[model samples]
Target: MAVVQADGRLWMTFGPYWTGIRMVELDPGTGKAVEDAPVHHLATRPDEPYAVEGPEIVEHGRHSYRFASYDACCAGVNSTYKIKAGRSASVTGPYVDGDGTPMPEGGGDLLLAGHGEYVGTGGRSVFKDRGSDWLAYHYYDAEDEGTPKIGLNRLK
Candidate 1:
């Protein structure tokens, strides 16, 4: 996932391997990551790093929130993916959940999960629309033969 910071720098986070996620700042003009920048590990789940993926960061007020997909994906109705969240005061950080659990230690508050006809609610992105923050993601619809569909929610 990518975000343009308030300082006008482009930053991104991604998992090169399903179990490993990293964040980096980029040189906007060159479209390349800053070589000397410190690497930030977004996935450090001791039990199952594979459970995490599709991370996105959003800045709100004085904090930056990190949202990510956890568990299995790409299985249609069988998928177990869900969304989790943590927040930090700095852009490159040690994000923590509401309970003060460090995210790098496999901690995050459940933000969204599959329920009813919605299966695998993951791959989320938060953005602003009409002065309100919105979450956009995709999920498999159990009532529709497990077809993938886009989902959106206005964050409060």
Candidate 2:
């Protein structure tokens, strides 16, 4: 979940702790942490278990996006993870979802969720290619006896 970034927007994928997700500017040539670059703390869940992870930042036109996964995952048929998203005008942000609630305040727009045999759809990556955005992630397929399946969806 390491995102290769320029424009001083380095998105680091983080995990079970959720708070571990950080945004820092890096030196592209050396792939090392840049000096004087402040690390911005991203996501957290105080009420439930800290299940958020897999952070990605994508710049689309005039807006910047923050993507994450929420809830439990990797439990096959029992996985409860789902994909969530937020957007900001700035790279290092106080991101707000579609409803305008702040991300650090447990706010995110639900992008993907479990349905029928598709259980726990999470672990996501986003990329912009050829003027189109693509969302890729993994989900548990109960129809196939809870096997892991890759899902690719075109996004706006």
Candidate 3:
């Protein structure tokens, strides 16, 4: 689980079925999490069934919070895998996409994915730099065929 601290509050993301990622807000005043707070569903589909996993939350600018996760569409048989992101002005949001669509039922641009050369890419670790951000993950080395190797790159 990855956590993001903002405005003296802690935010956590988790998935019960590995299909939908949800966020919970913690109240520092009571030292307990607010259960009734709305949980934001990470991904939703209208056609093919998909799962959202490996959720990471980060505080971007001063007031914006970004949420990231790996989306796996079509579980079996060469499933399409990619990293996606969404952001909100508050820690616990109604996160919106690049086009201002709500993430619970909204879709965003593909941050990273396989490009024919790489088989598939998912599982992401997002971290902050001096003032930038980076993403680290494992990908199947094309040269090695089926060998999985770690890959790291600046997210900018």
Candidate 4:
């Protein structure tokens, strides 16, 4: 999700499942879509079964960071999901991960992945709260029969 300019147009992902994510700008006054606005084609993994989703754009310092979750999810012990990140100089981007890999080309810098009892950690969202940044996501716990768990992290 992203807020474009001071007009408060909230842009979020709307999708038809594992295909791709589209960004639609919403009308702030009514929290409805501004009907005539163009639907932006944001990003997609070219790979079949394209598991990319959850796009969150954050404007920090001189860059806009684009966060996305990749790989399979929701199958308990079978999940292979993980969170990835990329940044661009502009809101609309040819976003590249740390090594300069473009997101659309299946490139993303690792943000979070399974560790210990946690497996398939993904579906992350980043935002600012009271002048500080935060990241939150879900994971499947392997230590407790694969139950889903939520994790939160405060970013500096």
Whole-model Cα lDDT of every candidate shown, in order: 0.83, 0.78, 0.65, 0.77
Show how many residue pairs clash in every candidate, following the order shown: 0, 0, 0, 0
List candidate 4 stretches off by more than 4 Å. 1-9, 30-32, 129-131
Best-to-worst lDDT order: 1, 2, 4, 3
What value of lDDT does candidate 4 attain over all alpha carbons?
Answer: 0.77
Ranking according to TM-score, highest score first: 1, 2, 4, 3
Candidate 2: tens digits of C-alpha lDDT, residues 1-156: 556454654544444444546676667667667788777766666557767788887777777788888888899999999988888887777778888987778888999999998899988888777888899899999999999999999996
**Which candidate number maximizes TM-score?**
1
Candidate 3 clash pair list: none
Give TM per candidate. Answer: 0.91, 0.88, 0.78, 0.80
Candidate 1 lDDT over residue span 12-124, tens digit each: 88774356567888877887888898778866566854568777889999988888888888899999899999888987778889898888888899989999999999989
Q: Indicate the residue-level lDDT of 125 in model 3.
A: 82
Highest lDDT against the true fold, candidate: 1
* lDDT of candidate 4 over 19-95, digit per residue (tens): 76566677767777778977766667788778887777887888877787778889997888888888888666767
